[model samples]
Target chain A: MGAVLLATILAIFTTMILALWRAIAGPSVYDTIVGVNVFGTKTVLLIALITYFSGNDDLIDVALVYALINFLAVIAVLKLIRQRDLAAAPEGGDD
Target chain B: MTELILDVVSGLLLLGGAAFAVIGGIGVMRFPDIFTRLHAGGITDTLAPLLIVGGLVLQSGFTLLTFKLLLILLFLLFTTPAASHATARAALVAGLQPVTRDSTDQKETRSSNS
Candidate 1:
């Protein structure tokens, strides 16, 4: 079981590296945002796996908190982008 | 025997989730525009974590840990899609055009009218 869990974690880490590549190379801002979202998801999974491997159920609460924080951050960034865009638009008209 | 079976199944699920996540990253990097990338990333954002967490819960067996894992999954399902939707809507409002190989003119027209 330990071996299996380790393999799973290794695979997840590989996926996270790929996501980091996308985040760095993304042409548009939203693509980067997508990459960040993927990263956050992977982090949540990693925490769960760690909890299993370390025999530490206490880490599960930390994982839950991270998940909640990640979601809220994404929403806040989205709102900021929208407000910035609206402010940039010409008064009484759009581009 | 049952424990062994559960371990194998959980390992497989974790692997599958990792695959989905990598594919989502590829989609984000290779897709021409924001909207399609969002679709791909959103899939990973919600489903991949759920799969991996589910696997970990199984590996943890019937413990309080399992319940906590389930809570994490529930929170992800509730929040991920909402975040993606908000991001996409914000991108649209910010003038990020949806790329179509054959429909550049349509996008221009739409943007012009906005």
Candidate 2:
């Protein structure tokens, strides 16, 4: 079981490296952002897997927090890119 | 016997999830444009976590830990699509055009003519 978990973690690491490559070499800003987003999601899974591997239940909370932060970070970045100002209203919306 | 069965099930789920994540990563890296990449990333954003965390939930059995695992999975399920949509919309609004078949065909014809 431990071996299986370890292998899963390693496989996720491979994916994270691939995503990092895209983040670095992606042709456009959104590509880079999406790559980073993928990387962060993998990180959350990795953390969760490690919790079971190491018998650290506490890490589960960390994984949950990480997921929340990852989602928020993506939305915030998208809003920034779209509006150029975070506080400004979206297009055709009442400000 | 039941424990062994559970272990096998979880192992298969974990391996399958890992495989999906790698495929998604490859797609994200190899796809030609942002829209295609977003589509690829959706695999990991959606299925990989579903399988992986579901396996973890099975392993944890009926404990509080199981609920926590499910919580994480649920949060991911709801947020990933929202994030993907926002990303695609932002890309479009920022003047990034998706590459369509017609556009590609036009480009190929123009190149051949040149």
lDDT of candidate 2 over A12-85, digit per residue (tens): 99999999999998677888889999999999999999999999899999999999999999999878876788
Best by TM-score: 2
Pairs that clash in candidate 1: none
TM-score of chain B of each: 0.82, 0.88
In the range B1-114, model 2's lDDT, one tens digit per residue, is: 999999999999999999999999999988778888999999998999989998888899899888888899999989998989888887776777777666447452111110
Against the true structure, candidate 1 reaches a TM-score of 0.82
Candidate 2 docking band = medium
TM-score of each: 0.82, 0.91
Q: Which window of ten consecutive residues has the lowest lDDT sum in model 2 chain B?
A: B105-114
* Number of colliding residue pairs in each model: 0, 0
lDDT of 1 by residue, A35-75 (tens): 88888878888888888789877888889899999998887
